[model samples]
Target: MSADGGGHLKMYILIRESVPTGFAVLAAAHASLAAYLKFRDAPEVAEWLSGPFYKAVCKVTDEEFEKAKAFEDHVVLTESALGGQEVAIAFKPRREWPKAFRFYRLYRS
Candidate 1:
């Protein structure tokens, strides 16, 4: 649920801050689609597809990127153009998230 306990669902895409701006945007898009394919059958994904569908793209430090991997319902995206380096992570849509997620900085140029 949202902070207000609504029925909204959201997916989160976290890109490494070190990635270039253009690559970061592509990474977020790639990660979103990949994560959706991976979790397409999930009830949460279905519910999200039925709703307005919200997403947050955040810039993460290297440490935060590692920490994001601790979540189970996520897809790690490796950029072949970047020598196979991991560039982003996309979490499955959910009604709620860990409190720490609220602190991630939004991706901004």
Candidate 2:
């Protein structure tokens, strides 16, 4: 929150889940800086077969704190380098090939 109590960056993450129970929510935030977090244990086939999924709970409160601090101080999301995600995830845009010639034209005697 700012002097007037307003957040700068808001984020929404998408994960696959389906259960008769209910919705799942999670977050971690700082006093006035930033935050980040994740939600899981949806009880879907994958969740159960994968991790014995069940009812979830809040793992981190005041989440956005870290992200807010990072933006305030201009830090990068390199935690993936540490252990979050495998690096080297590069995207090379597809190249368009040149148009093909309809037919060959030549002079003959």
Candidate 3:
């Protein structure tokens, strides 16, 4: 979308809750950068980059991360230290926010 009719581009970054604060931040960063690079050419992402880029960092359990990977439009971040665990997930920017993500709140730490 072109940020018209109140449809703004937004990316959701979900990180594993059990990870340390530093690791969580790193994972979230990795996810965000990966998503941006992957979708940078899209019109919505380009608009977001040109204007105010919006992102939401949320906490997700390991189970949640696993489930989220099933989504087609997601980028997963893996960490070897965590035993090749999926540390974070970044969903492609969408005009309509997915209802599935309603449970995830903003990252506190």
lDDT of 1 at 100: 66
TM-scores of all candidate predictions against the true structure: 0.93, 0.15, 0.85
If both were scored by lDDT, which would come out higher, candidate 1 or candidate 2?
1
* Tens digits of per-residue lDDT for model 1, 1-109: 3532555788989999999998998999899999999999999999899978899899999999999899879999999989999999999998778766878999999
Candidate structures ordered by lDDT, highest first: 1, 3, 2
- Candidate 2 residues lying further than 4 Å off, grouped into runs, are 1-8, 20-23, 26-109
Clashes of 2: 15
What would the per-residue lDDT of candidate 2 be over residues 7-72, giving only the tens digit for each residue? 222121111121011221211111111111111222222333343222111111223322223322
- Candidate 3, which segments miss by more than 4 Å at Cα? 1-6
Candidate 1 worst ten-residue window by lDDT: 1-10
User: Model 3: per-residue lDDT, tens digit, 19-43?
Assistant: 8888898898899999988887888
Q: What are the lDDT scores of the predictions, listed in order?
A: 0.90, 0.19, 0.80
Q: All candidates: CA RMSD in angstroms?
A: 1.7, 23.5, 3.2
Model 1 TM-score? 0.93
The 10-residue segment of model 3 with minimum total lDDT is 1-10
